[model samples]
Target: MKKILLPTDFSENSWNAITYALQLFKNEECTFFLLNTFAPAVYQVEYLLVMPQPDETLNVYKESSLRNLEMLKERMQTEFSNPKHSIETISIFNTLVHQINEEIQDKSIDYIIMGTKGATGAREILFGSNTVFVLKKVKCPIIAVPETFTYESPHEILFPTDYGINYQDEHIQPLLNLTGNNVARINILHVDKGRGLTEYQERNKQQLESYFKHSAYLFHSVQNESVQEAIANFQLKVRVNLLVMLNNKHSFFENLFFKSTINQIGFHLNIPFFVIPTKLGKK
Candidate 1:
């Protein structure tokens, strides 16, 4: 069974992401973990040194968190009743990233699906504060669902890579599982900056080519525009259903969204983004 970890703040945005994940893996048997983390509004040093959890504020937060998790589970059961999907709820007084990492081990989670932000937040921000922190701290594969994105079959996937990091089997496993399950075609786009691939990059490219040998994919190289512009134009031209990238430091993924000619987030990023954490490579 597939174990999918869903961290929710009980907001519509988080609910949006949960709904998308359910529909995305509707056919496959999955156990979804609905988790909500809470911390006291204020922590007193005396309380921390003495009692781990206080009586008043901590109790209030715990009750609220538990209530919200139960409600979310009920909502999921009522709205999306699928024999293949079973959901479990968790309410913990911990930080988001720490809770997620713990659950990844406790439940053997496969994917962490979450919204980019709460409510209709500014699209200028690529990810919410929690999400960006989680991306940096968590090594598990995660899917960031935009606030207003409607669920769609990920038939066409757009993968933007600079081929900077060495390829690893663990890094590619999630992509392989997803594409293999959906029988989707991958469109690999390489943004040309008037320079050729370095020897290391070429090696990584060859490895990627080998990995996709039995799959249907097209490699496109485009130039004369910024990487962000290139991505938006490609999405416009192809109507891609998903956009994927690795959070590899010092790579294109690190700076992909910083500068754009439009100066705003596009539906290009609105498409469900599959982010593979870079540090997930072999220990």
Candidate 2:
């Protein structure tokens, strides 16, 4: 069965992501693992040694996580009525990012679905944290659903890349799984800055071309505009249902997303975004 790991903090944004994941894979038999990580509210330090009574704090957190999971499950069953779907809940009293990485390996997670925002605005800004951290750190593919985005069929997918990183089989597979004989049109968009493609970049583009040669895909290029603006305009003109990007450091994907303000992110992305992390290049 397909195993999907969904990390939640019991926030409305997290629940929005959960509902989107359920509907996205409703027709397929899948097991959804609902995971939540909690840390102690207070830590005691003595002689430069910090101690946390994990057991004391975790019991209540576990209870609350379980209850919320049950509530989400019931709502799904009542709304979708899908018998093939199965769900499991896990609560960990540890750092969120650390626990997520550990569980991704331990549980053999397939994909991660999560909320773009966290518990509070301050926590989101100063730390430059939350789902963005998960996206950069996690070795698996992540589908970040905006809190306000409603579920929609992925009939048209907008993929923006700079042809910087070489495409890998692992990176492409998850996207293919989502598209799968659905008659979805994949728009492979490349934004040029007047420099044009170098010989090396052309070869990389060919590599992508060879992979999706048989798939219903098209290649397009737009020049003289910023990557973010191009993508936003493309979505508006084509009415894309999903946006896909390969997050390569210093690439347009990174600049347009990683450096932008959180509230402004939705301005560019009205649809759900699937982020595939590109392996860092050796210096």
Candidate 3:
């Protein structure tokens, strides 16, 4: 059975993401872990050193987190009552990324479905701080749903790559799994910056082709435009439901996403984004 980890803050944005995940894998047998992490607003050294009393703020935060998770689970059961999906709730008094890593390891999570923005996310920002941190720090595959995006069949996928890192089977397995489950057409986009593909890039590109040989895909090239522009124009031309990328440090993923000013991004992402992590120069 597929084990999927979902971290929620009990916000509508998180709920929308959860619903999207359920519909995305409705036909498959899966276990969904709903996780909520809480920390005290004020850091007190004594809070950690001493045992928690009933009236302590730590207990209060823990109770609220557990209560909210249970409520969310009940709502999921009522709204998306799928027999193929089993729901589990987790409430921890830990940091978001830390607990997420723990759950991923303990539960053997396959994928993480989360909102691009959090409860306090700004509208102009493409991704919230938590989402960005996970995308960079966590190695597991993630599917980030836009807060306002409604669920749709991912029939068309847009994958933009610079072919900087070597391709691995496990690195591309998430994309493979999605394509295997859905009749999706992948549009492999390569943005040309006047410099043609190098010998190494050519070999990596060929490896990608071999990986997706069984899936329906087409190679697309755009010249004299930024990667952001190419992606925006491509989405305009084709009604893409999902956007995918391999988050390699050497790739364009960092330059396009890891800007100091989040709002400076040129394109507005409206579809679900699938991020597959790969180490730098991983063979």
Candidate 4:
């Protein structure tokens, strides 16, 4: 069964993602884990010294979280009736990024479906904060659904890579799984850094080409811009239905996503972004 982990703050944006996931995987038997992470509203060092029982203060918050989860589950069931799918809800008191990392490992989660607002106004300073954090740290594929993005079959997937990180079968498998035997086009985009490809980079690209030999795929190289700009421009030119990236630090994915100010980044991706963890690339 495909295991999907969805984190919700119970916002309408999150609900849109949850609904999208159900429809995306309607044909397959799947297990959905709805997760919520909460931290205390306030914390003081002096209070910790004087008040020994922190659990007492957290009890109320925990209770409220459980109630919210129950309500969310009921609403989802009523809206999307899939007999082959089972839904489970979990609430934990911890940081969102840490809890997500732990749960992915413990539950063997297959994909993480999240909603992204894409940094609005002051929020642009920290672009895709939670989504970026999990993208960097989690050990699974993450499908970031843009807020209010209606679901559609991914007929064209735009995947941007540098060939810096070695391509692994497991890392690419998720995309293949989503595409199945459908005649979907996989556009492998590589940004030329003016220095041209090293022998190692060329060989890695070849290996990647070999891996997707059976699928209808193309490799294109573009020059004279930042990796993010190249990708955004390519997406507009190709009219892609999905964006896929392998999250690796020091690579274009990290530079465009983690290192840049959220507002400055121009991907403004309206389609689903499939972020595959770098560790999953390990053989």
Q: Candidate 2 on 1-283: residue-level lDDT in tens? A: 7789888888888888989998899888899988887664463224113444455645887788678878877776787778789888887666677777777778777788987743344233312267767776777778888777889888899888788877888768788988883668899999988999998889989999887876789998999887767887787689898889887777776666567574455443557889876752111
Error of 4 at 102 (Å): 2.0
Candidate 4 residue lDDT tens string, 164-262: 878888778888888873458899998888999999899889888887887889888999977768877887788787889887767777767675464
Instruction: Find the 10 residues in a row with the least total lDDT in model 3.
Output: 48-57
Candidate 1: lDDT of 127?
68
Residue 137, candidate 3: how far off, in angstroms?
1.5
lDDT of 1 by residue, 1-283 (tens): 8899999998899999999999989889999999998765475444444655546647878888888888889989999999999999898766678779889878778899999853344444566778877877888899989887998888899998888879887777788888877868898888878888999989999999888888899998998877778889998789788888877878877666433532354534678889987766222
In model 3, the runs with Cα more than 4 Å from the true position are 44-55, 118-123, 280-283
For all candidates in order, the CA lDDT equals: 0.82, 0.77, 0.85, 0.81
CA-RMSD of model 1: 3.4
The better-scoring model by TM-score among 1 and 4 is: 1
Every candidate's CA RMSD: 3.4, 4.2, 3.2, 3.2
For each candidate, give its TM-score against the true structure: 0.88, 0.86, 0.91, 0.88
As for lDDT, the candidate ahead, 1 or 2, is 1
Instruction: Return whichever of 2 and 3 wins on TM-score.
Output: 3
> Which pairs clash in model 2?
none
Predict model 3's lDDT versus the native: 0.85
- Model 1: clashing residue pairs? none
The lowest-lDDT stretch of 10 consecutive residues in candidate 2 is 119-128
